[model samples]
Target: MKNTILIGACLLFAQQLVKAQSSSYKPVEGKIMTEWAAQVTPENVHREYPRPQMTRENWVNLNGLWNYAIRSKGQAVPTSYDGEILVPFAVESALSGVGKTVGKDNELWYNTTFSTPKKSRNDKVILHFGASDWETEVFVNGQSVGKHKGGYDPFDFDITDHLKSGKSQSLQVRVWDPSDEGPQPRGKQVNNPHGIWYTPVTGIWQTVWLETVPEVYISGLRNASDIKSKRILVTPEVAGIVDGQQVKVSAWKDGNMIAEQTVNPAEMAKLTIKDAELWAPGNPVLYDLKVELLDGKKVVDAVGSYAALREISMAADENGIQRMMLNGEFLFQYGPLDQGWFPDGLYTAPSHEALVFDIQKTQDMGFNMIRKHVKVEPATWYHACDKMGMLVWQDMPSGDMGNGWEMKVGVLGNQSDRDRTPESEAIFREEWKEVMDDFYNFPSIVVWVPFNEAWGQFKTKEITEWTMTHDPSRLVNSASGGNFEMEGTKITGDIIDLHNYPDAKMPDPEIFGKDNILVLGEYGGLGLPVDGHVWQQKDNWGYQSFKNQDELYARYAGLIEHLGKLVEAGLSAAIYTQTTDVEVETNGLMTYDRKVIKFDVSKMKSLHSPLYNK
Candidate 1:
């Protein structure tokens, strides 16, 4: 009875501590927020697993309230934190509970305590970060573990040596992001938010977790599918590999093992899938993968993954016009320009369901593809696309400005290239390569867009050729509506793309048909501002604004009708303005809150069906 009373008192004390930590923090006043914002709490923040492509059974979610401090750069860690900030949400976001800005002059520090999971003698504790903005340095148990310098990539550090023998461990992270002031690929983040730019995101903006692995285990897996050859290439990168370590791979379909192969850790394993079903927008068939690391006859490590077999290429149709071929057939791709922003969370979605909701809604609206504009999303976004049968046109976020945009409506125009500093160029190249390699396994990505609308575009020919050579499997759009650096009157890349606002328009087939696939990269930004659902009540605008839903629907239908005509004129694909209203941009299919879908889903789907069928 005495012990039970003591336990109750301790539980009450803990609850009071949590309440006290959250009491001082509150979301900023007078800004639009989503339904998910109210549902966010420290106990249930980002409870889902971080990585979908690579799955492990044992893992710990380190997402919740973490002690945060803002101090000037180069200053030592503060003895005490100002308040509790939610993990995986930027400090500048309302969801974080500390809506404070951490500029370049200051560093954002995060400190959290986690109980160590049960481990075997040979087990290694690995700490993983889904993503953080700009530059980040990590410390475990007061010892510096490692540092990473990419805002949009997942990275990990082996914390086995840093963990002290104890039930509880200390984890600390220090971050510095210059936003627009620095020459990093920040997308639309600006220190001063206005016009196309929004608030800055600092510190961790995605999931943070820990996993235990054996000393000799699979470090990484790169799955490349060759539909033409009917083979799946599995490259297994192993850590702590011994001389006799062997890796076994098996492919499963419908819970039945159809193919298996065993190879050395250093060699690539090719599994030939007989009668394999191809993956496409209409039919996204995925095969289950199981990998086992064996030491002699005993299994040392194992992981579960999945992949799909699909092919993307460009070829001339019967009319001698270039068309985008999916699995050796022409399929017209039509979808929205997904900017991937949220009112409450900025770059980070409020929940995994929220992240998947956008893609599912896009699919329900009958769109076949989504051009992720000027930003790279978490791997879960791509995984959602892969599972839901959505094709993705991934963009490399632009950086290092000073290039003037040349809107070449019909006549040829010349735009000067921005001569970037050596450091800036190296930063762009390294991050771009890392982004590609990290996201290469996802089957939904079909196109790689290096530059968008000449924002920091430089050495177009060299960059295009390098991207093409780096990944020959995918088509490269050198620039989307960007300045075309011509080599004797021909565009450098695979697709000739154009941007026209508030209506349907395409590049002339007579000019680009023989050499490149013509596409309307951006168009149709029809906006309708629903009261109580906008980022701001006043000054909310789109490319074109409408007073009512009927007007918006009528204009959208007309655009689709005109787009069909362009498709007949050799336009292979088209991307509309956006998926959701962001900031002051009210030209989205849905409102910023995601509560009101501006269009009728069934009618939109029906209208889009004829375009693919034709």
Candidate 2:
């Protein structure tokens, strides 16, 4: 009886300690924040399932207040931590509770404890990280699990053997990110915040979780559809499959099974849907997918997935100029250049709803496309785009901006690719391929922008051709508003894109449109910084600053009116300067805080309607 009382007292003390730590957690102040920041707490932060494409039932979110410490690089793990930081938010971000920078000289460490999920003997426990900046190493119960590089790709490690004999397990993570000090693909993050470059993001900036799955299970699903053939192609990646193990794939629409097929693991299961509906902007149609792994008719594992029947291609118009096609139709694409950043979270959205808000507002303003500018977003952002029918031109997060650039169009022979070191080249190749492969299944991604304005541009022909060959289903914009390399008599890639500012402009159709699609990659950065919504009180600027709402709308309408003429002259698409104000750059349709829309939504929609008619 005395031992039992002692155990109860210890449990209560532990509970009280946790409560005290959680109560001490609060977001850092002294910055412009969004409404969603108020809703964030240690218990309810980013609790949504990280992966929506391939999902299972049993999982645990590891996003909450974790013990964190910043120590010098290469130093041994410290025995004590400084304080608690909110997981999934970068250490420099306001949402992290501890808003401090861990530069190249220091390394960030995280420690947490979680209860193991209920699983059978045949189940394997897997630790998943949605994303971590630069280099990351994981330790489970003091045993080294694995290490992963690349800040934008999801990675996992099997920790079943590293588990302890109790329900509770200890997790420790070590992270090092050389924001501007190294040659990794960090997008627009600089050591010093100035001009276009914003703040640095380090350590974990995405969700980390755990899952329980069968020893031999479906590891991943590569889902793609051929709209012309009316067939959905599914390649199930099985981890450990013995003899007589096969994969069963089914396609459903409106709760009815449209097609089903069974094939050996790693073999493509083609399910043909009769009278297939093509997916496009404003009419997004999604078909559900259910995949099951069977061992001689005994189901070993199952997962839920989805796909869409769509195609993005290039075709010639009556004017002998190439145009972008969606599902074989020439619908002009127009949207904003979305720099996916937040004042509070830096690299992450405060919540999933906050991530969708920008897309939804853009849709309400009558834009059907978005150029994800030089930054790859979380998978949930792309999934939201897929469901909401938003066309995406995904950009590789830019880095290694140490290249010399000459953007003169007339002097064609002056352009050359950046000669990077062997180490730098290899890093770019590996991360770019991983980024492409990680988000390849999302249908919303139509165009792949490999280089933006010569930032880390290298091996132009080789990289462009590889991207084209890697994913033949989508068009590759070799370098958006960057140095263009000539191939024989034609341009290197499928599109010839130009960047203009403060006014509407298009690529010269008479010179290059016959062989490539002409597009205005960026233009119209009309700025109106709201009084209380600006990131900074003074010195905020845009491509063209406006006085009030009326003036901003009038100037934007004029740009739209001129863009319609470019559409008729063979411009296939156009992306405005940005979606929201970022830092001191106040050239957004909405303020940095997202509290005010510079123009009326209905009026902006009406103004943009005419450009689509052509």
lDDT of 2 by residue, 17-121 (tens): 877877898999999999999999888999998889999988999999999999999977668999989999999999999999999999999999999778898
Model 2 ranges with Cα > 4 A deviation: 1-21, 409-414
Clashes of each: 0, 0
Using lDDT as the measure, which candidate wins?
2
Candidate 2 collision pairs? none
Q: Output the worst ten-in-a-row residue range by lDDT, candidate 2.
A: 406-415
lDDT of 1 by residue, 28-66 (tens): 667788888777777788898778778999999998889
Which residue pairs collide, candidate 1? Answer: none
Residue 23 displacement in candidate 1 (angstroms): 6.9
Model 2 residue 409 CA deviation in Å: 4.6
Instruction: Summing lDDT over every window of 10 consecutive residues in candidate 1, give the lowest-scoring window.
Output: 405-414
